[model samples]
Target chain A: MFKDLDPLLHSQLRLAVMSLLIGLESAEFTFIKEKTNSTAGNLSVQLDKLSDAGYISVEKSFKGKKPLTTCRVTKKGLRAFEDYVTVLKQYINK
Target chain B: MESENQILSTEQSLEIITRMIRQAHGSAKRNSVYLIVWGVAIILANLGMFILIWVEYPRPYLVWLIAIPAWFATFYLSYKHRQEARVSSHLNRINSFLWYSYGVIIFTIVVFGFKINYQLNPIILLVSAVPAFVSGTIIKFRPLIFGGVLFWLFGIICFLIGGPWQYLVGAVAVATGHLVPGLLLRNKNDEQHVQGS
Candidate 1:
C-alpha cells in the first residue's frame, strides 16, 4: 500500500535537505550547504519552506560569537520521506 | 518604566516545541540504527573469539582481529549511506565518533597483542581510554568516559596480575565500553521514537 506524502518535499534540493536531516541529529547550516551544494539563499528559502510545512526545525545561535544555523528533521519529515520512498518504489517496481 | 511585552500563546509554544522534539527524535532514530548494527557486529566478533579460546584453538587471539575489516566495512557502508542520503554533520559527528571508537579498540588490540613491549601489556587498559575521552569530549557522554576510566584501571590491575588475564581484561573492557554505550544510545533512540509516534 502506498502512503501519502507532501508534494512540497518531492523536489530535488528539498528532498536532499530532508534526506540529510533525516540522517542527522542536527546539522549546521554550512554543513548542509556544503552537502547539498545549494547556494545560501536557495537553502535558506528551502529551509524556510520546510519549516513552514512543519517538516524541519531551524535553530539559530552563535558559535564563538559567529551566527550558527542548524537544521533537524521532524517526525513529520521522516514520515514524509518514508512515504515518498514507498511511492517511488512503485514506479521502479512498475 | 513600563514596557510593552508580547507573550506567545501556549498553543503556539507547544507547536514549536513539538516540532523541535520531532526533529531531534528523527535524527536520533537514524543514528541509533547505525550504532546498534555496529554494536551487534562487535559483540558477535568478540563472541567468536571467545568460542575460539574456549575450544583451545592455537593463537585464539587472532580471532579478535576480525573486527579490523568488519569495522572498516561498517564505516564504508555508513559513509556511502551518508553520501547517498546526505546526512547532516550532527549525525555524522555521532557516527564518526562511534566508528572512531571502533578504530581505537582495534588499534589497541593489534598494538598490545603484537607490537608493544610484553611488559607494558597493562597499558592496554589505558588504550580504551582514548575513545572514552573522545566520546566524553565530543558527545558529552559521561558514561563512555567513565567506562574508559574503568578500563584504564582494569588494564593496570591486569598488568599487575600478569598472564592471560590481561587478554581477558582487554577484551571485557573494549566490549563493555562499546556495548554499554551503544545499548544506551539505542534505548534513548527508541524512547524518542515512541514519544514521537
Candidate 2:
C-alpha cells in the first residue's frame, strides 16, 4: 500500500514554496514570489496557509523603511518534507 | 501555476521535486569575493616579502603591510553582500564558518609570531591547507583542492629551502593555491549567473 501524500504540501504552489525553503536558512517573501512567479495576493494566501499549518515560520521586520518578510521551514515542516519525499520516491519507482 | 486547479500526476509531482531541488543547488555558487581578495593580498605580501628579504632589507616582513587593503576590502564587500542578500542558506553559513575560523587562526599566529620565533613559512602554509581543502571538498570545487595540495606540498618544500628563501616558496604556494583557484571560482560564478539568468 502507498503512503498518503501530505495534503498541506500537495498543492503545486505550496510544494514549490516548501521545496525552495527546504534548502535555505531563510528566504524573503519577495524571493519566493519571484521564484514561484505567483501573484502577490496568491502567494500571500499560500504563505498564510503554510504558516497556519505550522509548516513554516514567518518573520516580519523593516529593512531601512521597507517591510521585509522572511520565512523558514520549521522542524516539523522539515520532517513533513522528508516523509513526503520518501512517499514520492516510492510512487515514482513503482 | 495553480490557476486552473489541475491535478498533478506522479510524473508532474516528480518533476516539481526535481526542479525545486535543482533550484536549491543554485546557492552552491561561491561568492568568490573573499577568495579573490585574500588571494591577491597574500600573493602580493608573499612576493614582496621575498623580494625585500633577497635585498637584505632590515624589515622584510614590512612588505606584508601591503595586505591592509585586503582586510578593508573584505569588510566593505561583506557588508555590501549582506545588504544585498535576499536569502540565507545553510551553505552560506558553512562557508562563513570555515573561512572565519581559518581567518582567526591566521591572525592568531601573526600576533604570536614573535613567541614562536621559528620560521613561519612552513607553519602558516601547513595550517592554511585545512580550510582550502575542506572547503574544496564541501563545494566540490577541484581548483581549491589543488590549491590546498599546493600549500601542503610546497609547505614541506619550504622546510627544506629554509630562511628568507622560504618566502619565495610561500609566494608560489599562495599564487597557485589561492589566486589561481580564486580566479577559477570567479569565472565559475560568472558562468552560473549566465545560466541562471
Candidate 3:
C-alpha cells in the first residue's frame, strides 16, 4: 500500500521553504522570500502556517531599526521532512 | 511560487527540494576577507622584521606592532559580515570555530614564546598549518591544502636553520601559504559573483 504525502508539505511554496530551511541553521525571512520568489505577504502566511504546525520555529527581533525575522526547522519538522522524503522516494520507485 | 494550496506532483516536489537546497548552498561560500587580511598582515610583519633586523635596527621586534591595526580591521570586517549575513549554516559555524580556536591557541603560544626561547617561527608555522589544511579540506579547496603543507615544510626548515634567516623563511612561508591561496580564493569569489549577477 502507498502512503499519502503529508498535506502540509504537498504545496509548492511550503515545500520549497522547508527544503531551504532543512540545510540551514537558520534563515532570515527576507532570504526565504527572495529564494522562493514569493511576495512578502505570501511567504509570511506560509511561514505562519508552518510555525503553527510546529514544523518550524520563527523568531522575530530587530536588526537596528528594522524588524528581522528568522526561521529554523524544529526536530519534529526534521522527522516529518525525512518521512516525507522516504514516502516520496517510494512513490517514485513505484 | 505557486498559490497557497496549489498541490504539486511528486516530481514537482522533488524538483523544488533540489532547487531550494542548491540555493541554500550559496550560504556556505567561503569569505576570503579574513584569509586575505591576515595573509597580508603576516607577510608585512615578517618581511618588516627581517628588513629591520638586517639593517641592525635596535628594536626590530617593534615591527610586530603592525598587528594592532590588523586586529581592528578584522574585528570591523567580521562585525560587518555578521550583520550582512542572511543565512547561518553548520559549515559557517564550523569555519568560525576553527578560526576562533586557532586565534586562541596562537595567542597563547605568542605570550609564552619567550619561555620557548623565542623559537617562535617554527612553532608558529606548524600551528598555522592545522586550520589551513582542515579549512581546505572542508571547503574542498586544493590550494589551501597545499598552502598548509607548505607551511609545515617551511616550519620544519625553520627548525633546521636558525637566527635572522628564520624571519626571511617565515616571510616566504606566508607568501606562498597564505597570500597565494588567499588571492586565488578572492579570484574564485569574484568569478562566482560575476556569474551570479
How would you encode candidate 2's per-residue C-alpha lDDT over B1-197 as one tens digit per residue? 57425577768777877777656554334456677788778878888887887788998778788778888988898888788788887766787788899889988888889997957789999998988887777677888889998899998998888777787788788888888887787777533421110
Which regions in candidate 2 have their CA more than 4 angstroms from the true location?
B27-30, B189-197
**Lowest lDDT block of 10, candidate 3 chain A:** A1-10
Q: Score the docking of each candidate (DockQ).
A: 0.07, 0.65, 0.90
Per-residue lDDT of A65 in model 3: 100
Give the winner by lDDT: 1 or 2.
Answer: 2
For candidate 3, write residues A4-86 as lDDT tens digits: 99999889999999999998899999999999999999899899999999999999999999999999999999999999999
Q: Could you list the chain B TM-scores for each candidate? A: 0.59, 0.90, 0.89
| Docking quality category of candidate 1 according to DockQ thresholds | incorrect
TM-score per candidate:
0.48, 0.92, 0.93
Query: Over the stretch B1-106, how does candidate 3's per-residue lDDT look in tens digits?
Result: 8786776889999999999987776522346677888888888899898899889999988888888888999899889888988888887778789989999998
Arranged by TM-score, best first:
3, 2, 1
Of 1 and 2, the candidate ahead on DockQ is 2
User: Which regions of candidate 3 fall more than 4 Å away from where they truly are?
Assistant: B27-30, B189-197
**Highest DockQ against the true fold, candidate:** 3
Q: What is the DockQ of candidate 1?
A: 0.07
